[model samples]
Target: MYERVEEMIQGYIWKDLGVKVIEAVDGEVTLHMPVKTRQTQFHGNVHGGVLATLADMSMAAAVNTLVEEKEFTVTAEIKVNYLRPAAGDFLEAKGKVIKRGRTLSHCQAEVFDDSGKQVCFVVATFYMFKKE
Candidate 1:
């Protein structure tokens, strides 16, 4: 499943955000996103939007592992807890599928800084649908 999804994972955001797949298998995925100065807010910390994007994307990637051909997942909603100001050269997000249903999946992710400190946590619900 991971091998099949890997072929389709390099979409626009994956390329533009500089997201690297550290591990993606068995309904779990770990991703690395290089932090850029442009991603910082006025206070010089990683912007909340960037953190949210990473969190959402990581969850999506986790959900992707469980889908079949012509099937995909879209985030219906997400809750993000910014634990600390993200300050580092890069960030790592570990996403895991908490529960999977026929039409929805609940997942959670933790984003860590370079020092291995968790900077953010996110729980999300994604809607699964098949393309006609």
Candidate 2:
């Protein structure tokens, strides 16, 4: 199941995001992103906005795995808490669904640096739309 999800994420339309779905189990998903200079902010660290984007993407992908169809899920709301600066070889984001409904999902994601330190935490709500 996880391998299939990983394949789906790697083939995502937005290839530049560099999102690599690593594992999924029990509604949890782990994804890796290669950090580049373009992903940094003025402080030479990965931007907070980028981290939030990664969290949202991971949450959406994680929840999508549980859904029956390939519905379009959009981030309705996201609250991110920064724990530390993200300046490392790579960034990892892990997501899990806290609650899943027919059309909405409550999810959470945690971002970490290559050194295995927490960098950010995000809580998000997703709206699943029918495929047109």
Candidate 3:
């Protein structure tokens, strides 16, 4: 499952984020990002969009863990709360699938700084697709 999700995250989409996989297990996954190649806005804060992408990717990985081999997922809707400004050496995102259905899954992810201070909270829904 991790391999499947990891493959989906590859290519040009998040190619520059330098995201590293920490752990992947059923219904949960953890990801890491370094500040060296971090994308920041003009104000020098971590770009909100990048954070949202991380949240979405983590949630997708979590959902993939519980799905059939041919199933894939894409974010259908997402709500992100920027709890605090992100600043540090690195960031971590931990995602979990709270509920699942045939067509959609409910998931959540929290992005934390190096000190483990949560800088963002996200709730998302993922729509499932199957290979024909």
Candidate 3 lDDT, 6-94, residue by residue in tens: 68668565567878778899999998988653478777878888888888878888898887878878899999999988877888999
Native-to-model Cα distance after best TM-score fit, residue 119 in candidate 3, in Å: 0.3
Pairs of residues clashing in candidate 1: none
Each prediction's RMSD to truth: 1.4, 2.4, 1.6
lDDT score, candidate 1: 0.88
Collision count for each candidate, in order:
0, 0, 0
lDDT of 1 by residue, 1-132 (tens): 385457646688788899988988878989999999999999998999898889888888888888887887889999999999998899999999999888999999999988899999999999999897
> Would you estimate the TM-scores of all the predictions?
0.94, 0.86, 0.91
**lDDT tens digits, residue span 1-132, model 2:** 654365566665437877776877767888899998988989899999889888887887788777755466778889999999999878999999999888889999999999999999999988977875
Which structure among the candidates has the greatest TM-score? 1
| Candidate 1 wrong stretches, greater than 4 Å | 1-4
- lDDT of the structure predicted as candidate 3: 0.85
What range of 10 consecutive residues in model 3 has the weakest lDDT sum? 6-15
Backbone clash total for model 3 is: 0
**Of 1 and 2, the candidate ranking higher by TM-score:** 1
